[model samples]
Target: MKADVRLMVTADGSHTAINQTLDKTYHSVHGAFQESQRVYIELGLLAAFEKFPTEELCVFEMGFGTGLNALLTAREANSFQRKVIYTAIDANPMAVEDAKQLNFDDLLATDYLLKLHECPWNLPVEITPWFTLTKQESKLQDWQTNERFHLIYYDAFAPTAQPELWEPEIFTQLAHLLLPGGMLTTYCSKSYVQRNMRAAGLSVEKHPGPPHKRDILRALKMG
Candidate 1:
C-alpha cells in the first residue's frame, strides 16, 4: 500500500508525525515520536519492565512505524542492565532509505534510525549484547510465534482506518501470546476496543493519555 507521507508536529513539539497519503492510517495529527515515548516507552513499556525487573525482557510491537519505540526502549534497556528481545511486525515496512529521511536521530539521543536501518528484514539481528531486533515484513494476522512477550505495544493505526486489527479475535490472539501478568498498552481508549480486550480475556484499565489525548487503554493478563 502506497502512502503519502508528510511531516506534522505534535502538541508538545517533541516529535513529528508522518501522515499517510492514501488514508490516515499512518496519519498522526499528534507528534508520532512524542506520543510513542509518552504512551508506550515511558508509561507502558518502561513501567512494565521496571515492575518486573527481569534480566531479559521480550517485547512485541504492532506497528514498527519509524522505529521510535524500539529505539527508545533499546536505550532504556541498555541503561537498566537488561536484555531486550524486541520483535516488531509491520505489514508495510518502510524502506530503510525512507526511514533515514525521518528526524528520529535528531530527536532521540541514540543513533536509532541507523540501527533500524541496519536490522535485517525477516531475521533477528543483535544491536547490542542486550538488545536484539527482529523486523517481520508481514501482517500481524498472518504472523505466528511460540515466543511469549512480556509486554505488547499496540501501536497500530486508528480503529477506523484498520478495523480488522481492532477486533476481539486479534486481541484474543495477542492475549494468548502474552505470558501471565503480561501487559498491553495502546493510545486508543475507544469503548469498543476496551470491550474487545476484556472479551479476549484481558483485564483492561483506562489511564490518562499523553498531552494531546484524553485517555489511553492498558490491559494485563491475569494469573
Candidate 2:
C-alpha cells in the first residue's frame, strides 16, 4: 500500500512522504534523489538504453509517488536529446497542492514540478519536446495498456510493507508489460522477491545500491 499523507525530508535534503498506513517512506531514508538515480536512472534506464539502443524509449513506472522518478527521467530525455514516453501509475496520488509543498524546488524547475502534478490523469501530456507523460490513477491490477515498454521502474514500497505487490503474479504482470529484453529495476534485493521475479520469467540480477541500501534488483525479459 502507498501513502501520500505527510511529507518528510531525507538526510540528503530530498523530499519523501511517509505512509503511516504501511509505516513506510516513499524513498530511501538516506536520500530520495540519490536512490532514484541509482535504482532507476543508472541501472534501469541507462542499462536499458544500452540493451535497446534507440533515440526513443518507452518506460512504465509503478508507484509514481511524488513524481520523483518521472522528473529525473524527463530531465535526462531533454538533456540527452532523446525521447521518452513515460507512463506512470499510482493508485492513490496525493493532492497536487499538497505535493507542491515538498522540497523539490531546488532539484527541479517550479513549472515542471507543477505540471507534473497538475497534468490530467489517463491522458498523455507533453511535458517537454522530448518527454511525454501519461499519469494513470489506477492500481497495477486494474490498469491496462496496449503499449509495451522498454524499461519498467519497479519502485513500489518495500515488499515487507506491501507484500502483495511483490508476489509472483504481480511480477508476471509486469513482465507482460515489457518488450522482449526490457528490464525491471527496484531498490529491493530480497531473495524472496528475486525468486518471485524469476518465477515470473525474468532473469534476475543484483547490483550495488545507493547509500544505506546494499543491493538492488534488476530483472530482464528474454528476447
Candidate 3:
C-alpha cells in the first residue's frame, strides 16, 4: 500500500483501502465486495443489460479505486457472454502493488484482479473475450472522451468529503455522457444528491442499499 493508503478488512471479510489523506475508505466498511456487487453491478450494469439487451455495453466509471467494481463487472460479462467496453478514470490511481493487497482473488476466486491493476493505463486491454478495459489517469472534470455510455459507476467519495464532485453541474455533465435510457448508480442517496440529479434532467430513484447503508441512488436518462 502507499504511505497514505492502508488496507483494512470489511465486515464481509473482503479487503478495502483507507485513504488517510481523505479520511475515507474506498468502499463501505460494511463490505467492500458486497457493496460493489449491489451498487455497481446489480444496480448499474445489470440494469443496463436489461434495458439495452442486445447492444454491446459501454460503461464509464468515475473512480476506479481498487478495480473491485471492474473485476466484478468483468466476471459478469464473461458469465453472461456479453461484451463490455469499460472505461475508468481516476485523478490519482493506486499503484499496482497496492492493489495486490486487496484479496479480490480470494473473494472472487479469480486472478483477474491483478490483471486489472497491472494492465496498461489509457489504453484498452482485453482482460477476457467479453471484457475490455481502458483506464485513464485523469480527473472526471478534465477527462475528454467522445464515447457515450450505457451505464456509469459513480463511486466517488462522500458529498461531505468532496462536495464539489456532487454538485448539480457535475451531474449535468455526467447526464450528458449517458446514452438515452442509460443510467448511473452510486452509493450516495442524500436528498441534495437526488435533487441535483433531477436538476441535471435525470429521473432519480431510491433503492435499498447494502449493509450499513439505508439507500442508494439510481438516476436514468429518459429518452
* TM-scores of the models, in the order given: 0.92, 0.95, 0.97
> Would you list the clashing residue pairs of candidate 3?
none
Instruction: Supply every candidate's count of residue pairs whose N, Cα or C atoms clash at under 3 angstroms.
Output: 2, 0, 0
> How would the candidate models be sorted by TM-score, starting from the highest?
3, 2, 1
Name the candidate, 1 or 3, with the larger TM-score value: 3
* lDDT, model 2: 0.87
Worst 10 residues of 3 by lDDT: 1-10
Q: Write the per-residue lDDT of candidate 1 for residues 25-135, one digit (tens) a residue.
A: 342456666677777887777777776885478999998876778888888878876888999988876666666666666766677667876678878998877789998
| CA shift of 165, model 1, Å | 0.5
RMSD of each: 1.9, 1.7, 1.4
Candidate 2 local lDDT, 1-223, one digit each (tens): 3344788889888999887777789998899999999999999887776777664799999988888898889888887778899999998887787788887757666358778989998899999998999998888889887989999999888878778898999999999999888889998898899999999999999999999998998999997
Q: Which candidate wins on lDDT?
A: 3
lDDT of every model, 2 decimals: 0.79, 0.87, 0.92
Tens-digit lDDT string for candidate 3 (1-223): 2336889999999999988889899999999989999999999988888988999999999989999999999999999999999999988788887987889888798779989989998889999999999998887888878899999999988887889999998999999999999999999999999999999999999999999889999999999
Off by over 4 Å in 1: 1-4, 14-22, 25-27
Alpha-carbon runs more than 4 Å astray in model 3: 1-3
